[model samples]
Target: MRTVGNDLVRHQLHENRKWYLLLGALLIIFGVVLLASLGMATLSVVFLFGILMMVGGVLHIVAAFKIFDGGYRWLWAIFGVLYLIAGYYAFTAPVQTAVVLTSLLAIALIIGGIIRIINAFMFKPLPGWGWTLFSGLLTLLTGILIIASPTSPFWVLGMFLGIDILFQGINYLTLAAAIRNIPPSSADV
Candidate 1:
């Protein structure tokens, strides 16, 4: 008769939903804290930032897996490169990295606003045009604000980054948690 111990030798550990939840939460919080550091850092060891960046890139790539488009895959791939570059630069040249990120955010906002405006015009027999126009205006204002104070946009960056990561972590944890509530697979266990 095979004992439980014999089975234990071959049985794999069930997925630890809690562990992934903790990791996701930690990654999110850490990302924001690092952003708040604003090019100022004092790590006990070297390459910490780089390692964090690579992990961040991988997370983003994984997130992209749910998206349904070749374009999204490419986007995630490019995002991974950016993350690695950002992390490397943060560790090696924090000041420069800060400047670059600050500039990039401003540019991206401006372009996003322009795209919204273009999209707004493209819609005909305009349904919910008012909301779209309002959103566009808000986007423009955000872009302008960034342009006005690009040197120190940490407040905006920190707030937005924190909010985004917090929500993302919550969403992922929720999905994982839901798996537990569902019935286990019916396949012969």
Candidate 2:
């Protein structure tokens, strides 16, 4: 009446259970630390983002010269220069960078939410369209709230980061538990 598939996958997951547990524990610890030092952690995250942008810019510049042959190389170079300047400013003034980035994030969320809402309506014939619409509405509300309280970026960014980390840790833990609980058939290794 029913079929079971991929015994080897089950065995592998069982074998790797310890690693999953370890990862979950590590994430939970990091989440706790993030929550404890919310402001400092937020600042650190912003600075790290700046560093990543610089690295991305460098890579883009390199790719423009080495990877691309003709058309968009100059455009890539210009983008690289802009990224470098933005990264330098972010590193030099992390607090200000965080504020500016927060505003950008708000704008992005609003635009993305609007797009999602429109797409949901376009795809109304598909299953789970309501969920998509709900998610878009939630995103829209969150963006609006963030924009309304423009001055609370410091706390908002910090608290959201910590909460996200905590949820990630919980997700890992749940995944490990689910893997452990999976029933193996006779074909299992």
> Local distance difference test, per candidate?
0.63, 0.83
Candidate 2 total steric clashes: 0
Cα lDDT tens digits, model 2, 129-170, are: 998999899898888888899575676677678888888888
Please write out the lDDT profile of model 1 over residues 126-185, one tens digit for every residue: 798667767777887787887798455445555555566667777767766775664443
Cα displacement (Å) at residue 180, model 1: 3.4
RMSD of 1: 11.1
- Each candidate's TM vs. the true structure? 0.53, 0.79
Best candidate (score: lDDT): 2
Ten residues in sequence with the least summed lDDT for candidate 1: 38-47
The worst-scoring run of ten residues by lDDT in candidate 2 lies at 1-10
Best by TM-score: 2
- Runs in model 2 deviating more than 4 A are 1-5, 113-137, 184-189
Look at candidate 1 and give me any clashing residue pairs. none
